[model samples]
Target: MAKDDLVSIDGKVSSLSGGGVYYITLENGVDISAKLCGKMKKFKIKVVVGDRVTVGMSPYDPTHGLILHRHKF
Candidate 1:
Protein backbone atom coordinates (compact mmCIF):
# COMPACT_ATOMS: atom_id res chain seq x y z
CA MET A 1 0.00 0.00 0.00
CA ALA A 2 1.08 3.55 -0.55
CA LYS A 3 2.21 5.67 2.38
CA ASP A 4 -0.66 8.06 1.97
CA ASP A 5 -3.15 5.23 2.32
CA LEU A 6 -2.42 4.93 5.99
CA VAL A 7 -3.68 7.39 8.59
CA SER A 8 -1.80 8.07 11.78
CA ILE A 9 -3.79 8.81 14.92
CA ASP A 10 -2.82 9.68 18.45
CA GLY A 11 -4.48 7.73 21.22
CA LYS A 12 -4.10 6.48 24.77
CA VAL A 13 -4.07 2.78 25.50
CA SER A 14 -7.24 1.82 27.33
CA SER A 15 -6.58 -1.84 27.95
CA LEU A 16 -4.53 -4.87 27.07
CA SER A 17 -5.95 -7.97 25.50
CA GLY A 18 -4.63 -11.46 24.88
CA GLY A 19 -1.81 -11.99 22.39
CA GLY A 20 -0.23 -8.56 22.86
CA VAL A 21 -3.12 -6.59 21.51
CA TYR A 22 -4.16 -3.20 22.87
CA TYR A 23 -7.36 -1.27 22.90
CA ILE A 24 -6.85 2.45 22.48
CA THR A 25 -9.17 5.41 22.69
CA LEU A 26 -8.45 8.10 20.19
CA GLU A 27 -8.63 11.80 20.95
CA ASN A 28 -11.77 12.04 18.89
CA GLY A 29 -13.40 9.30 21.02
CA VAL A 30 -13.01 6.43 18.62
CA ASP A 31 -11.94 3.15 20.13
CA ILE A 32 -9.68 0.88 18.09
CA SER A 33 -7.85 -2.40 18.52
CA ALA A 34 -4.11 -2.32 17.87
CA LYS A 35 -1.11 -4.61 17.82
CA LEU A 36 2.52 -3.68 18.27
CA CYS A 37 4.54 -3.45 15.11
CA GLY A 38 7.46 -5.76 14.36
CA LYS A 39 10.11 -3.20 15.24
CA MET A 40 8.56 -2.61 18.64
CA LYS A 41 8.71 -6.30 19.45
CA LYS A 42 12.24 -6.65 18.11
CA PHE A 43 13.35 -3.72 20.27
CA LYS A 44 11.48 -5.05 23.31
CA ILE A 45 9.42 -1.91 23.65
CA LYS A 46 6.87 -2.28 26.37
CA VAL A 47 3.39 -0.91 26.01
CA VAL A 48 1.14 -0.55 28.99
CA VAL A 49 -2.36 0.59 29.61
CA GLY A 50 -2.76 4.38 29.77
CA ASP A 51 0.29 4.91 27.60
CA ARG A 52 0.00 7.32 24.71
CA VAL A 53 0.66 5.83 21.26
CA THR A 54 0.50 6.53 17.61
CA VAL A 55 -1.64 4.07 15.64
CA GLY A 56 -1.42 3.61 11.92
CA MET A 57 -4.92 2.92 10.68
CA SER A 58 -6.22 2.19 7.26
CA PRO A 59 -8.73 4.66 5.98
CA TYR A 60 -10.90 1.77 4.91
CA ASP A 61 -11.12 0.29 8.37
CA PRO A 62 -10.83 2.56 11.37
CA THR A 63 -11.75 -0.08 13.91
CA HIS A 64 -8.29 -1.70 13.84
CA GLY A 65 -4.71 -0.50 13.49
CA LEU A 66 -1.05 -1.07 14.26
CA ILE A 67 0.63 0.72 17.15
CA LEU A 68 3.45 2.58 15.51
CA HIS A 69 5.03 4.63 18.25
CA ARG A 70 4.82 5.08 22.00
CA HIS A 71 5.08 8.52 23.52
CA LYS A 72 7.38 8.64 26.50
CA PHE A 73 6.84 11.22 29.21
Candidate 2:
Protein backbone atom coordinates (compact mmCIF):
# COMPACT_ATOMS: atom_id res chain seq x y z
CA MET A 1 0.00 0.00 0.00
CA ALA A 2 1.08 3.58 -0.58
CA LYS A 3 2.48 5.50 2.39
CA ASP A 4 -0.47 7.85 2.25
CA ASP A 5 -2.84 4.93 2.25
CA LEU A 6 -1.38 3.46 5.42
CA VAL A 7 -3.30 3.73 8.68
CA SER A 8 -2.13 7.31 9.08
CA ILE A 9 -3.25 9.72 11.76
CA ASP A 10 -3.74 13.49 12.03
CA GLY A 11 -2.57 15.91 14.68
CA LYS A 12 -1.86 19.61 15.13
CA VAL A 13 1.69 20.83 15.52
CA SER A 14 2.05 22.51 18.90
CA SER A 15 5.61 23.69 18.58
CA LEU A 16 8.81 23.29 16.58
CA SER A 17 12.25 23.77 18.01
CA GLY A 18 15.88 23.54 17.09
CA GLY A 19 17.49 20.09 16.76
CA GLY A 20 14.38 18.79 14.95
CA VAL A 21 12.04 17.95 17.84
CA TYR A 22 8.40 18.95 17.61
CA TYR A 23 5.45 18.99 20.02
CA ILE A 24 2.19 17.90 18.49
CA THR A 25 -1.29 17.95 20.01
CA LEU A 26 -3.19 14.82 19.11
CA GLU A 27 -6.86 14.57 18.29
CA ASN A 28 -7.52 12.92 21.64
CA GLY A 29 -6.10 15.96 23.46
CA VAL A 30 -2.74 14.44 24.31
CA ASP A 31 0.63 15.83 23.33
CA ILE A 32 3.71 13.97 22.12
CA SER A 33 7.21 15.03 21.19
CA ALA A 34 8.45 13.40 17.96
CA LYS A 35 11.31 13.86 15.56
CA LEU A 36 11.95 12.49 12.12
CA CYS A 37 14.39 9.64 11.78
CA GLY A 38 17.98 10.44 10.83
CA LYS A 39 17.22 9.86 7.15
CA MET A 40 14.21 12.18 7.17
CA LYS A 41 16.27 14.88 8.82
CA LYS A 42 18.46 15.12 5.74
CA PHE A 43 15.58 16.49 3.70
CA LYS A 44 15.22 19.60 5.92
CA ILE A 45 11.48 19.05 6.20
CA LYS A 46 9.84 21.15 8.88
CA VAL A 47 6.56 20.71 10.69
CA VAL A 48 5.16 23.93 12.13
CA VAL A 49 2.60 24.84 14.75
CA GLY A 50 -1.07 24.46 13.85
CA ASP A 51 -0.20 22.51 10.76
CA ARG A 52 -1.79 19.12 10.30
CA VAL A 53 0.49 16.15 9.93
CA THR A 54 0.39 12.36 9.76
CA VAL A 55 2.25 10.06 12.14
CA GLY A 56 2.90 6.49 13.19
CA MET A 57 3.38 4.91 16.58
CA SER A 58 6.57 3.49 17.96
CA PRO A 59 6.40 -0.28 18.28
CA TYR A 60 7.07 -0.07 21.99
CA ASP A 61 4.21 2.34 22.47
CA PRO A 62 1.49 2.01 19.90
CA THR A 63 -0.64 4.59 21.71
CA HIS A 64 1.74 7.41 20.87
CA GLY A 65 1.76 8.51 17.28
CA LEU A 66 4.90 9.75 15.55
CA ILE A 67 4.81 12.31 12.77
CA LEU A 68 5.12 10.52 9.43
CA HIS A 69 3.28 12.80 7.01
CA ARG A 70 2.41 16.48 6.91
CA HIS A 71 0.02 18.61 4.87
CA LYS A 72 0.11 22.40 4.56
CA PHE A 73 -2.91 24.37 5.57
Candidate 3:
Protein backbone atom coordinates (compact mmCIF):
# COMPACT_ATOMS: atom_id res chain seq x y z
CA MET A 1 0.00 0.00 0.00
CA ALA A 2 1.21 3.51 -0.79
CA LYS A 3 1.76 5.92 2.09
CA ASP A 4 -0.45 8.55 0.50
CA ASP A 5 -3.39 6.17 0.28
CA LEU A 6 -3.56 5.63 4.02
CA VAL A 7 -6.41 6.94 6.18
CA SER A 8 -7.16 8.07 9.72
CA ILE A 9 -9.94 6.52 11.63
CA ASP A 10 -12.70 9.11 11.40
CA GLY A 11 -14.28 7.32 14.29
CA LYS A 12 -12.88 6.51 17.73
CA VAL A 13 -10.49 4.00 19.28
CA SER A 14 -12.31 0.82 20.23
CA SER A 15 -9.88 -1.85 21.33
CA LEU A 16 -6.24 -2.92 21.35
CA SER A 17 -4.67 -5.91 19.67
CA GLY A 18 -1.40 -7.74 20.22
CA GLY A 19 1.70 -6.95 18.16
CA GLY A 20 1.02 -3.20 18.10
CA VAL A 21 -2.28 -3.75 16.29
CA TYR A 22 -5.39 -1.78 17.26
CA TYR A 23 -9.07 -2.25 16.54
CA ILE A 24 -10.43 1.09 15.37
CA THR A 25 -14.16 0.63 15.53
CA LEU A 26 -15.80 3.17 13.29
CA GLU A 27 -19.17 4.74 13.95
CA ASN A 28 -20.68 2.14 11.65
CA GLY A 29 -19.38 -0.62 13.95
CA VAL A 30 -17.00 -1.91 11.30
CA ASP A 31 -13.69 -2.52 13.06
CA ILE A 32 -10.40 -1.82 11.26
CA SER A 33 -6.91 -2.80 12.33
CA ALA A 34 -4.34 0.00 12.67
CA LYS A 35 -0.90 0.43 14.13
CA LEU A 36 0.68 3.44 15.78
CA CYS A 37 2.88 5.72 13.75
CA GLY A 38 6.46 6.48 14.74
CA LYS A 39 5.70 9.97 15.97
CA MET A 40 2.78 8.86 18.05
CA LYS A 41 4.90 6.29 19.75
CA LYS A 42 7.55 8.87 20.48
CA PHE A 43 4.96 11.18 22.02
CA LYS A 44 3.73 8.28 24.15
CA ILE A 45 0.11 8.77 23.16
CA LYS A 46 -1.96 5.73 23.89
CA VAL A 47 -4.13 4.85 20.91
CA VAL A 48 -7.32 2.96 21.48
CA VAL A 49 -9.46 1.64 18.63
CA GLY A 50 -12.40 3.96 19.40
CA ASP A 51 -10.15 6.99 19.22
CA ARG A 52 -10.29 8.78 15.88
CA VAL A 53 -6.93 8.77 14.08
CA THR A 54 -5.37 9.84 10.80
CA VAL A 55 -3.49 7.14 8.89
CA GLY A 56 -1.08 7.20 5.94
CA MET A 57 -0.35 4.09 3.93
CA SER A 58 -0.83 2.23 0.68
CA PRO A 59 -4.34 1.29 -0.39
CA TYR A 60 -3.18 -2.22 -1.11
CA ASP A 61 -2.19 -2.79 2.50
CA PRO A 62 -3.99 -0.41 4.82
CA THR A 63 -2.63 -2.42 7.70
CA HIS A 64 0.93 -1.45 6.87
CA GLY A 65 1.40 2.31 7.13
CA LEU A 66 1.92 5.30 9.39
CA ILE A 67 -0.67 6.66 11.76
CA LEU A 68 -0.18 10.39 11.35
CA HIS A 69 -2.42 11.31 14.26
CA ARG A 70 -5.54 10.52 16.23
CA HIS A 71 -8.20 12.54 18.03
CA LYS A 72 -11.50 12.23 19.86
CA PHE A 73 -13.20 14.53 17.40
Please write out the lDDT profile of model 1 over residues 29-69, one tens digit for every residue.
98989999888999999999999999999988889999989
- Which of candidates 1 and 2 reaches a greater lDDT? 1
Clashing pairs in 2: 54-69
TM-score, one value per model: 0.93, 0.66, 0.63
- lDDT of each residue in 9-48, candidate 2, tens digit only: 5788888778777887878887877766444566777666
Off by over 4 Å in 1: 2-4
Off by over 4 Å in 3: 5-9, 27-29, 62-65
Candidate 2 shows a clash count of: 1
The TM-score that candidate 3 achieves is 0.63
For candidate 2, report its TM-score.
Answer: 0.66
User: lDDT for each of the candidates?
Assistant: 0.92, 0.68, 0.63
Sort by lDDT, top down from the best: 1, 2, 3
**Candidate 1: pairs in clash:** none
Best by lDDT: 1
